[model samples]
Target chain A: MRTRWIFGTILMLTLVMGCAKKKIETYPAGVSSNQQIGAQTKPYVTNHQEEQTLSSVQEQQGQTVEEQNLQEEKLKQAQQEKEDIRKIIAKRIFFDFDSYELKPEARKILQQKAEILKKHPEIKIVIEGHCDERGTEEYNLALGEKRARAAYEFLILLGVDANRMQIVSYGEEDPLDPRHCEAAWAKNRRDEFKIISSK
Target chain B: MKKFLLFSLIIGLFGVDFGWAKPLRVTIYGPAESKIYVFVAEPINLDGKKNSIMVQEVVQCIKVKLKLFPFFKQLSPKDILEQGKINDVARIDYKKFFLSRADIVITIGERYLPDTGKTRIELRTFDVFKQKMILGKAFDLTNQRQVVLMVRKYLGDLLQLIMGNKAFFVNPIVFVHKGIKKSSIYQIFADGFGLKKLADIQGIVLSPSWSFDGEKIVFSVIQHEQHKLGILDLKTGNMQFKKLPGNSCISPVFTPWGDIAVSLDFSGSPDIYLLDKQLKIEKALVKHWGIDISPCFDQSGSKMVFTSSRLGNPHIFLFNLHNNQVERITYEGNYNTSAVISPDGRLIVFSRLTPEGHRIFVHDLKTGQEKQITFGPGNDEEPFVSSDGYFVVFTSNRSGKYKLYYTTINGDGPYLIPTNNISTFSPSWSWVEEKYF
Candidate 1:
């Protein structure tokens, strides 16, 4: 009879401990068991069930706030990455006078742009072709298109989708440098990348 | 014997043999020796009123108009007055002008008619050598603004009577006045008066060409980094734009059939295409893997002259519409562009880049001869030949800033066209009827 009583007491103790642990787990990770107990012992006259419901609601509210913060951090990180992609693609590649042939440096820059464009499929860009004032307005327009097209084709070869790019020719109209000098012309003869759309 | 002695004395005073057998018909391309000496007499106030400013303005207008014809040498009014005083003649003395070697004498008489409250302007042109009046016209002016029109009309009649060609006086020149942020199209008289701002476009306006009827204009507008084709209905003063298939819209010109021929790259290359009146693509006119733009058609529409890079460098090519044969007309220059063909399709004027700068050159299609017409310290480009094929107007930076300068087809007198300090370019000269102005 004594041995049986001891076994029965140990079994009761295990069952009670399991029930308390389950009750604590039901509350939020932020709501400590000590805080729950302190809330239950408040001097204000209140229903016990109502007090438990209020604490549970508070725990849920706290959990939602923490989830919102994590989501905001993720959104901020995405925006930063998008801005870095924009800066990289906005870089300009230059060309020679009256010629649309891409130089080695231009090719290198275009490769980097293509990689960014590939990684960011939602981005749509316009490749603007520009020319120096040395050529006539009409011919320079065509030449500028050729320059833009050169860079565009090179980007396509580097695995950037052709549909993601459009081309325009400014043709001695929009100059980066307005001075009437060789250096200014060299700077003006370039291919500029513009981000049209980014989702 | 008195008449013979008088003639001999007149010949002796002038020191040149005076031919009275034929009326002096100043040939359009006469040599410098055959230049007609024109004497514009001082305006005579019929009522003896002190309107010296009006008189001076009228005289200045007449002299400026006369200067357009390279074959006419204007004798200073002061010198002519001094010569007349020496001869002691109050009225116009044909003998004194004939002795002074003045081939043509223009007389102006202004009288204020109080009955009608208007000024009566009587203009008469006398053949000095023939000793007879050739032409006379009178205008009733209600205000001073009509003075320019009256003078232009009188000169037009006089020029037609002399050279049988008066297209230059009636034609208006359209050009772009580039500003700091926006550019506007302006229409001015060939004599550099009547500057009217046609349109104040928001962005850059380029390559404005007049239709054959002169009632409409087609040009390219670059706004917000997009090139669009703009059509201006001069009759209603309405503007319409078309976003073409490609990003390029350059050198929009009117074909003789009233269609638009412009450069577009919708076909993966910059090629010349024909668009209908509604700005829809009719067909591709000039297509190549290389660059082609600036297509200018002759009056008959039988031929077109354009700048193309099919042969590797930018050169002017002539495309025959009848045969559809593409022949490269320019062979010398590595960079030749902005070509315009004469109305008769005989001459092509273009700009060729040289070591110094861009200069204007004329290539005769028949003779295959290319002659440099403009020698510039700065770039002189965008040559527009008049419909009469006698005058070539272009834009030049020879005066530190680009201004409109006009010269004869033979490269005579690239006179500055005053634009009131604003830089101008892309001159398009067309003959609109007098009623439009």
Candidate 2:
């Protein structure tokens, strides 16, 4: 009679501990065991049940190792795509008000652009000249023209062919930044290069 | 057969006629009689020795000089004085003048004084039905060569007074011809004829604006490594430059009197500054460190329309001098620039960049309505309206080259000025002289 009672109590204790672990896992990753349930019950039960099923399937099939490795490779490929997009820094050049003369900073930016162009000669580029809102419509137009020409000249000096490059002046017509603040103006007073056709 | 013919003839005599069925005249006149009547009278020279050529000759000369002004229907000089005495300045004679359909009669009297050697040409306006002479203003001139000019001036003034608006004959346009690439300003008639170079500056000249009298042009000239704003006398070749503090001045427009409203970058970003007659900075119109360029004064000079980047976008803003308040005028486009306000302040012509391309747009101030002015394959921008508010001057690359083009205010096809492909832009119409007005 004593031996039978001990076995029964041991079985009950084992059932209680397993039930407690299962209940704790059902609560969620950050939940405490002392927390009250019912009103605080979570929807994490589905994940826990799915994990239990998955573990049982893994024990039966033992293919989870290769599957997890494939997933890791896909994640890495997606991250590489994101980093590549970020690496393409859009370089903007600027000129003096009403002038098309390229300053040293503009030249430095264009030098980087030139290397990109040289590396990818198959790409076609467009140089757009813009002005800060100043002067008359016609005057700004002429100013924009001179600015585009200045950029075109520099790119040609760096081996970009006349046929492969096109220059357009937005005058004060196209502003990248559209605020009435200094930040917007600083962005507007620029010459931008767009790769019209890239390999 | 004889009996049938007789019956048909009898029926035909009483038949209803359809020939009298014409368009019904909508008698909007009602019982209320028309009050204002316009009459064109014969011109008379009072101070004889005929200082002017005959009426036909004077009219012909004006039509030749300004092909845009409509041709005048002339009457004999002898009939004008007689008509003035009998039908115009005298009693009502309602039955006679009303039968002749004359409610207001115009009498042009040209007088030449031998002692003063000045032609006292008087334009006598009469309210025939009221039996009142409204105006009898006289102009002084030296010779017959001045007759066509005098007639143009007097007729324009009379038309404005009678119409209570700017008469079409007076507004002239002035612009800089940069395609010819010379530093020269040219004046053209409204119809694009009578192209005359008003001033020949030795350096780069742009932004030609008319003075209050329309006889002077204040423009920006980059000469000797210095930017100068000078008032060029239209009739004479005399010019006086306003000394600017820096070489960064680009556009220079005139306010009333000799004061100037110019864009100066001395404080970093280009802002609108009021320079007195002495070229001293009076005050700043905008406080933003960003651009506040292209300041055009309203007809009243109490407000200005300029482009400001203060709202984080480059848009046209109106700065009221009285309130010192700035209001954004455009909201439809990401980029709106190069806006020129109409003389009446009822409309503004600006450039708006959309997905298709940059296009010239006219925004009506009253309705906040915007309409595209250019629809071409390439970009079109830098719109400047004519003095009479009938046409505009702009730059377009639709021809595969950037060139100066003009179109009617209604956005008709552009007329190419003779300037070549020097990438011309920023065209300003000069004020029409009193002769045209």
Number of colliding residue pairs in each model: 0, 19
What digit string (tens of lDDT, one per residue) describes model 2 on residues A31-138? Answer: 566664653665444676799988899775666667677778888886674344323325788776545679998888777777767766776776776777544453
lDDT (10s digit) by residue, model 2, range B92-118 = 344444455455565555556678655
What TM-score does chain A reach in every model? 0.69, 0.55
Indicate the residue-level lDDT of B345 in model 2: 72
DockQ, prediction 1: 0.51
iRMSD, model 1, in Å: 1.0
Q: Which stretches of candidate 2 lie over 4 Å from their true place?
A: A1-199, B1-168, B179-181, B224-226, B354-358, B376-379, B386-390, B395-409, B412-425, B432-437
DockQ (Cα-based) per candidate? 0.51, 0.03
Q: Model 1 clash pairs?
A: none
lDDT of 1 by residue, B109-129 (tens): 777878877777767667777
Model 2 residue B270 lDDT score: 59
Where is model 1 more than 4 Å wrong at Cα?
A: A1-80, B1-34, B47-53, B77-82, B85-92, B179-181
Best by DockQ: 1
